[model samples]
Target: MSLNGKVAIVTGSGQGLGFAYTRELARQGAAVVINDVNADTAAQAVAQIEADGGRATAVVVPVGTTDAAKALVAGAVDTFGRLDILVTNAGILRDKSLLKMTDEDFDLVINVHLRGTFTCVREAYAYFKEHNVRGRIITIGSPTGQRGNFGQTNYAAAKAGIVGMVRTWALEMKRAGVTVNSVIPVAATAMTKTVPYFQKAVEADERGEAMPAFFRHDLGFGTADDVSGLVAYLASDEAASITGQAIGAGGDRLQVWTHPEAATTEYREGGWSYEALQENAGTLFTAETLQSYGEEFLPLPEDLKPAQAAEAR
Candidate 1:
């Protein structure tokens, strides 16, 4: 999956998973545009990529505004001559339970993760159309969006919205040869380290200690690089056939998430009243047919190590 001569843009590429993606993409021979709100971090990332013999330029754009997004795309074209791939990885965590979450919290997360993705993709689409480029768009998604998480109502909603955008854009751009997809990654990056258990795992890893069993699943509680490989593959030409997908990349596991479907359906000759519906409630709503949220798909580190569970408690 050599990206030689390809020009790519990765938003929030100064640190964490975005940085990993930018580095890997540049390593594959693409001239990368690194966009981050922090000018210093963006310069450092650009310097590091250039130091490693990869071509990269920094663009300090916050990513939610239309002008900023357009400038980012324009900067890539001005610097690299053309654009081919876009990774909408800029995000922030404004976690709070629905009851406690403020309007500000909800709006910030939505603006950065959901609206930011929309603005970037919209600008990129315009550029791709003008240039007749078959662009690859890889949006960042989260498992919290697929399966709701406690105290993350806002974050989950925004992430899920990104996937919806990917689906619609995939259809809209299919005839133009542009592909849109989302990557749901779980890696030990700055974002994941915000969790207590993961913070411990990261600290332990830094000290050269063995991680708990749960953190060692599949390929282990790996670093950002572990997730970057999948993103790179999707950005490459080989993945042109794969669009409108939400792929999971964490540890050594790669998963294809099932799309929404109707699980059950019933028909009535006319509109049923509340009393009529109540008569068939038992058959319509059963315990086995109920859907649940807030269940952890992967075990926590403390769960795998009972002795340390006390600390987590």
Candidate 2:
């Protein structure tokens, strides 16, 4: 009800977290434009919304092209008469170690996740500025992006870049009353179901069983619907003051990630010569104790981890 009378566009809404986002928006009374590359899934999403007495339409497009982006914004305005929210939820993953990853794999992932978000947000902002609408733009991010992952070079780059863009856009859109922020969500979706680290949790979810406390509390992993409320809240009037932030949500956990900053700074009269830096290297970074690399899992419960992963851990 908080989003009643609003119009929203959620890319990649054919299924998974994207679908959950659109469904939540529609439930709150927004007329949604569900976009996805697959026509069947898009139509199915629209039908589901309509069955629930919520208004929605399907916009089938790849979303990485400017033309596709243009069509999405136009579809929202053309179908619902205006656009108030744009949630860039469409993305793809091609995971491989840096050495094994090919150019095609990297490019494909970047095209869908990074370029797709860029094109969609650019067009959405243009519409907002032209119509003088104080629109909400929610971009998706990932934990792998925040904390480096072993085989997610492209994905991490794209997602981190998205948050970086949000910070800049927040400053630029301040006068326009447009809020842009990144939601770094961890959830059990098609995208994450195959992750060996979460195989057990995913199986439990698929069977309609609750995820173990270790995953929900310690790992911040949960079903897609658990992350939707934050997306909806960020897109509503109440979150107008929130922008330029990277918020994390999954299961019962919510976190506000601090922006990158210098943890230790010392007086440098001449910006420090190499010889002086080498001498002070020991004490320069001592205060922060070297931030941990990769996401720190809190030791999964023995029964909750994949057999091999559990054995390895």
Candidate with maximal lDDT: 2
lDDT of 2 by residue, 3-97 (tens): 99999999999999999999999989899999989999899999999999999998999979999999999899899999999999999888999
Query: How would you encode candidate 1's per-residue C-alpha lDDT over 159-179 as one tens digit per residue?
Result: 889998889999999999999
After superposition on all C-alphas, the RMSD of every candidate to the true structure, in Å, is: 2.3, 1.7
- On a 0 to 100 scale, what is the lDDT of residue 138 in model 2? 97
Instruction: Give the least accurate 10-residue stretch of model 2, judged by summed lDDT.
Output: 284-293
**Residue runs of model 2 more than 4 Å from their true location after superposition:** 308-313
Minimal lDDT window, size 10, model 1: 298-307
User: TM-scores of the models, in the given order?
Assistant: 0.92, 0.95
lDDT of the structure predicted as candidate 2? 0.92
lDDT of each: 0.86, 0.92
